[model samples]
Target: MTCSRMQSVVIPRHFDYRVLKCKVSSISVWNHLSVHRSLAMNVRRLEVLDERAAGSGMGTGDQTKEMVPGGISSTETDLEDTDDELGMHEKHEQYLLDALSKMSHLESFAWSCNHSPISIDLLWPMLLKCHTLREVEINDNLVFSPVTNDESEGDSPNVAVAHELRAVALKSNKHVYGSAKHPDFTRVKGMLNSCPNLESLNIAYTQPRSLPHAHLSADDLFLFGRWPNLTSLTLTNLRCSPSTGLDAASSFLFAHLNLEILHLDMSPGTATWYNKLVFPPNCLPRLRELKAHRDLVSSLLACPSDAPRPLEIIKGVRLTQATDLQQSADAFFFNLRRHGVNVKRVELTSWHEMEDIRRLIESTPKLTWLDLGKKGNGNHHDRLGGSGASSSGAAAKSSSSSSSSHFSVVNANEWAILLSAAPELTTFHGVKFFYEVSLQAQASIANAANLPLYANGSTGNSNSGTGPAPGATAHVNLNLMNLSMTDRSRIRKNDETASMLAWKCTKLRRVDHWEDGGGKVVVIIRDCGDGKEKDKVAPRWEIRRVKQ
Candidate 1:
């Protein structure tokens, strides 16, 4: 579209007869706006050239030269014509300003690479006219940070206009936090405190902890004095210590009320330090979720030697490792138990074969959901002896019972204790076995279940029509993860006896197996309540979803 008698002009491709007379009346507008097609393309090429020169901290003029070819103006222009219309209703000047103030739907604002200072100075006045601004999104690509005069100490033009925003996001040019020796994040921090309605923030991939004057520690959390309405908070690489003003943060939450979620992603080594500070009962009155890496959980519960603090069942937790699995698990469980907190669901990951599922299960009695899958290819084992033994072992010597309960890394032995002890369990999950559990051993386990006593390969008809036998309710639900196609095929091929024996336990509801080639094999659940016990395939059971 051509403008009136401008020296440089971007002409419209089609000139209709109706506007020809109007175009001729303003020849100066055409001359002033006369921009050649080649010049526009050359300016586009300069984008990359400018980027390279900025990387080298060299002359921006040289970069601009590389942007345009021959006959290009060397000086930057004072005026820029973006020709953008107003965003909100602009029927009248007052109506437009009023619409801006009342527009609550506005969530983000960005002004990068669109206009320069002279044009920006005009843009801010128009934006400030928009009173409805809630969020300001400033992309740092187009010199979003203002050029400050050392002597005047004046603020950025956009910063002055951003006072009404509730949330501010400053996506920097790079992940320069902590790495930069002298970080200049003026606009970054300025917008943070500017918005009175600001409650949540996310600083993507920056090492803010390493900043000299602006770094925030756990201690600073108390300075804000508990935001009662604040429901969520997140921090990455925020350096914090166990002794750092836990009472103050807790007091803030208690006083203001209604705080629910807290997320801290710190150094891997010091991640768990926050767990050590126990929230006094009802301190975080509305808290429902706490998320941290495994290392953090370990650090929080590391000092089991100290008085156990009651950490109620948070809605969710993501653990990161298995090195201190049992200790961490025990501390988490015991802490929650102190407040009689019953978790409705718990999802945890481990690298080793979990030996502490029993303690974890018994601690969270209200647990309706449990997932104990391994993250990497690691196996963990629990201590052996009385605690791991079968019910009958209690009649034997306590020492024998202990030994029976004590899990051996040996393949067949641990299954014996686990199958017997975990009878009332609703959901049992584990990684695919590293070694195949023999069919004979598996059959023996099935025979030892709630089923009637029978000799090998023999139907015990002698006890036909007998009343319910002792301990007849023994049913275990099992879920398996990380099973390769080869491993599953091996079990199907090598352990026909075990599969057949599994068929005998009518109460077995579901078996989720990660069959190697079969993908995830979910054996249809079966209801084995029929009087006539058949040796054929178990019938498919119906699954009913009940609301909690």
Candidate 2:
């Protein structure tokens, strides 16, 4: 009898298979399909009882055989436990390993492992084998053994790792750069010259101490300048003096013109060095984005002032500190407008008071996105009281620190002024803690400027119009993540300042405020149509509360 015929011999579902296996311990089929020492031991026991019933002439063979889902016979069911199936299982595991190995191409593999020590030798072979390796992020107190070449006795990790990765991000280390015993920038330069396709480099440390200017010979540039495709470069807190290998890197741009992004987050003291030097014409004509955190905006802009075109294609700009706020503001905007660049977006890290904010907004008329907020307290008391308190000698001496700390708050108000200036602005993101007087006055100013306001809602759901007016979407976008105000009781309804805020921002879509227990309450005002549904209908604004 075949196994298929046995299925037609109806049996109880709860029949114990182990009892029958115990009775027929001497069976050959039971020995072949042993139940012991296997992961599927219980499955094997069921098969043994099944075979015993078939052997006992449960039914006739061949005609009434059962066909499995894969159309495999009982003969093939036995093949499932054979060596061929094991081979297929092994092949599947290898296929998975190959897929995981290729993931290093798009991502930084070094950062992927958070709490495991990476095997350098194991990885070196895989990296050498894998063609898709692009970025290697070895940070977070990682201790790696020095890389050794095949044929060198005194080989100090022959810098072969550079040939594999396009970009290397190294951070949080004891040494100034990546290596513990001081990194020779020449070794890195040599590695870069060897790799035909290397693009970006990121390194940040406690100090900027590597490579003496005297040691960086002219041969360095001759070797390094071979890379015509090199574009983006970033160096943070690197002790690169005027004489050091800085010229070797800069010379590449002067000779060939394919650089795009340059991020220099250098030490505060070394920032002023760039202002003194000048570059050749068309050195960096392809340059579009620049991020300089320490230097005064005026000095950095002075570097590319004489170029055939002064960064007309430039899109993004970030400045940490601006010297002589009013003067710096004027110079920065004038250069962009002069070039007809039309700076669409801007982020101001430091600006204090309503006057500075107003000046910036009025100057940059085409700004669409702005991230302007307070860094220091503005001497509002000084402005409100007519500068008389600071005019006194004794008061000036006692309030020097307080006065400086007070400037950041005033700087934050400058953002509101800029918003008023650029009525075309669509998105304003950042912490806003300006005084009520300035906010109200600026709101009125913005309203008079013809800036249309839309509440935070889906354009499809908007009853005001079919959708947002073409250029009006950029004006206001509030961050509603983890709101702090939940209940109307927590907000002082009768307070003079609170009342002013409520009335001033009549065009507001959302309002977030603080409540008890550090929770949030969000008030969403939607534009539901009034009783009349005319084209020019004044949409009703209904405020709904969202409790924490």
What's the true lDDT of residue 396 in model 2? 20
lDDT of 2 by residue, 124-156 (tens): 344444455566554422222223455234334
Estimate the lDDT of model 1. Answer: 0.37
lDDT of each residue in 35-104, candidate 1, tens digit only: 3332222111002121223322245543222211223242222222223434211222232223223323
User: Best TM-score goes to which candidate?
Assistant: 2
Distance (Å) between predicted and true CA of 47, model 2? 44
Model 1 clashing-pair count: 42
| CA shift of 129, model 1, Å | 7.6
Superposed Cα deviation of residue 183, candidate 1 (Å):
5.9
lDDT minimum window of 10 residues, candidate 1: 16-25
